[model samples]
Target: MAAESDAPERGAGTEKLWNETGIDPVELHLGKDSGYTLRAYRMSDTLPGAKAEEPEPDEAEDDDEDAPEAEADADAVPEDPDADEPDPADFEDEAPEDGDEEEDALDAEPEEVPVFLTRKGKLLVFREPAALVAYVRDNDDHDLAAVDEYADLQERVTEDDIVCDEADIYELDLVVANLRGGQEGWEPELLIKAAEVGRDLGYALKNDSIVSALAPGSPLDDLDEAFRVVAEGGLKGRFAKRRLKRSDPQQAAIAWRGVIAKINDHVEWRG
Candidate 1:
């Protein structure tokens, strides 16, 4: 994506320091707290430690994440004839022919995904611009420090350059309320922006549950697409409106609530 060059003006204008730098300051409103952070998108292969391993199963989740020990109720446990010799097919797939897999891999294109100013997989946000600027200038241990654009950030940033585009300011705190308002009250701009930010956070933070919840073709994603179509306003938009009318607002609200909770758990708030 092209860097946004024309950000809406603030104090001295939407601080052009980030413009064309492939990084932008953003304000996030979650629950009752609002904070400022930095985010950027880089090619998957180009990002430091880009290929995050599949996350281990959640400790709190059952069945979906992991099953309880069979020894807990040995008397009730069903006898399994094939438990001893597990099927090889269930554990792993047959390796593809040597050069064919390599050729296809070379032909595939790398995609761009979001990365944030995180440390040890936790997002770092600041309550004050001065704090965030100081951290950026003094800290080199954070994940973003490995990116090419980060050098410019260290050399050029100041407290005044911490401005964010209005478009980049996400009000996630209000997403649940808007969703609970039902179809008539749904705000396309608000819902769409929430989805965009959630997707970025999910990938950037390596939260598999969040990624799965908002994956393409999931119910929430379908809702996002419908809202986008309705926002477009045309004959198709009328059909989309009918679709949105059938969608459950409460379900959407709950799903978003879970994603927010997961994100809040991983946030490292600073002042």
Candidate 2:
């Protein structure tokens, strides 16, 4: 009888504390034999604060415990710009692989696409060696291997690749024009390679001439301009003149100066 009388007073105190602290009680009902048990936690824990998060290392401080959440919330956001940034070391690591890929690509002797991009990438497209050989003679397809062997003469003969002749370069220019999609101007590397092909074939100014001819003019005039350049002296001519002069003393002073001018004329000139 005495314990039952004390229950009301205990209940009153509990109610008062709940009101003061704004904490709700969760009555977890156990088995009927166990009866019910009441547990209390801050109401915020189950209400507006349910989604509240912890702070991150880089966040600033704030008075409210919830305020620390602002920093945490910001941290959840993604930094997209940082995603695109690359490590400098990546290029160094990839360089050897890239070189190997290039060598394999070359050695694999993939059929050249005439100005058509390689499956590897856009930068690798050139006048297909087969096509260049074919351009010389229709049946040269059988002879392409021989032509390629001839083209490689620079490596064996001069320690460097020879340039392509103008006729062949013109064919390459045609191939470049036929390329389904590519930037419409001549790339210097392409010019250099064309010249190499010509040199290998024993055409003095053919490749360089073709390259100059392909230089872009107005939107519609590019192809026509290329034709003119091929007929006239293009970079190939300039390169050939310089080469001839370098090999010959009489034309050395004039030829070397011209070569310097030609080198300067091309954007690839480093010296």
Candidate 3:
């Protein structure tokens, strides 16, 4: 069969469909908001009456700094009787100009450097991701991965291949240059270096291993001397009696388990 007229002619339900598509029958009839329209205009027929939102009132000034510096300046400026002071009227005009410029500069977004940071000693070093990448690119001695590795540190540590933020580089460089004494000594310096490399990337020290290493009497003895006394005592009494020593047999047992865990988590035991 010949294709019957597949078009909406002049005056069928065509006008109704066109309205839905944002095309008004009258060319310049304003107010047409339709999903299909090329131009966004709200049709008067579809709109509902509603009051406009009122602008909010100015907020109360902050005690710390939200108060304009002009007020502070006025309060702070001393009355110099001997010295010829500038005109007060002139000061008002100058204040707004200076304040406007300062406020403009202050209101402007800060220049954001692409980096993160963590602390080592008294210094906050730029952290990994951006800082590490930049450091590795500049220094021939360190690789990218090593830079990443060192930047991850958080606590007591040491690693050879590391990158650091400027503050850390300064602090660690100075500390290592002039070694000192105390409980930290070498360990602290080492940890400082490690923090620069990657503070977070650390072998989680099993508290048990530390406890075991700290055993009394002999340097070699892994168990605390109190272990024997506690072992002799019943569990509760043993735990209660422990002051400077291990009293909980269960905790001791846990430490033994920690030794095993330490061995498992150790990075160098595969061979």
Candidate 4:
């Protein structure tokens, strides 16, 4: 009888905590350590409200008068016969400018969001856990090995695994600097890897063929041309010897370094 009486008091305390913090107790329990917790609130809950009051007769009368005045003014306006006649152009919608279309395309591309790993090696990708689960389920036969490898990798990765937050852009800068300085032991493979990383991060243009990776008239176009000249004999064979033979290697290096430095300067670190 005493335990039954205490149950209501405990329930009341839980309700009080939930009302104050806006966190559901069930969600807190379900998310534990291995899962993620997402809480969304309605806009009305966050916004302040005006107190309800009796209607003002004078204000209501003023609004009624204004509505008729607006309608009367709109009706009083005279229309020209020429204005009523429509041209063929008026029937057709104006075609969007190429530049406007390009800007829209760029805006439509989704921005990359941050992802985290739970202690139990579960990947917590923002707003896409269900999609990820479905993908894993669909490709179980072909992707089981890859899934296991990723699980192992996530287990080893911690907050300390981050060497530099800007390592993606920094690696490109470092590779370009080495090329500029004519530093020995900087392999062609390093440049290839940098290109791949840059493209993955949306910094570099995607190209179908390796030779056409860098866009024309881009900041890195000169560097791409230089790379092409050096790699004419192919990527693997005598790369260092061919790289040294460029007519203005120093100028190309300086340009590449400036472009990368400008990019690094604009990078922001978000917590």
Per-candidate clash tally: 0, 15, 19, 0
TM-score of each model, paired residue for residue: 0.76, 0.14, 0.15, 0.34
Give the alpha carbon lDDT tens digit for every residue of 199-256 in model 2: 2222112235333432345212333334335445779646544443223222322322
Q: Rate the local accuracy (lDDT) of all candidates.
A: 0.84, 0.30, 0.30, 0.38
Name the top lDDT candidate.
1
- Model 4: residues >4 Å from true position, as ranges? 1-78, 82-86, 93-170, 181-186, 202-222, 225-247, 268-271
Using TM-score as the measure, name the better of candidate 1 and candidate 2.
1
lDDT of 4 by residue, 160-215 (tens): 22221121212353555556656354445445545543343233111233223344
Clashing pairs in 1: none
Give a tens-digit lDDT track for model 3, residues 129-157: 24433442344331111223322332212
Q: Ten residues in a row with the worst lDDT in model 3?
A: 28-37
Candidate 1 lDDT over residue span 121-168, tens digit each: 899999899999999998889878777879887878888878788778
Best by TM-score: 1
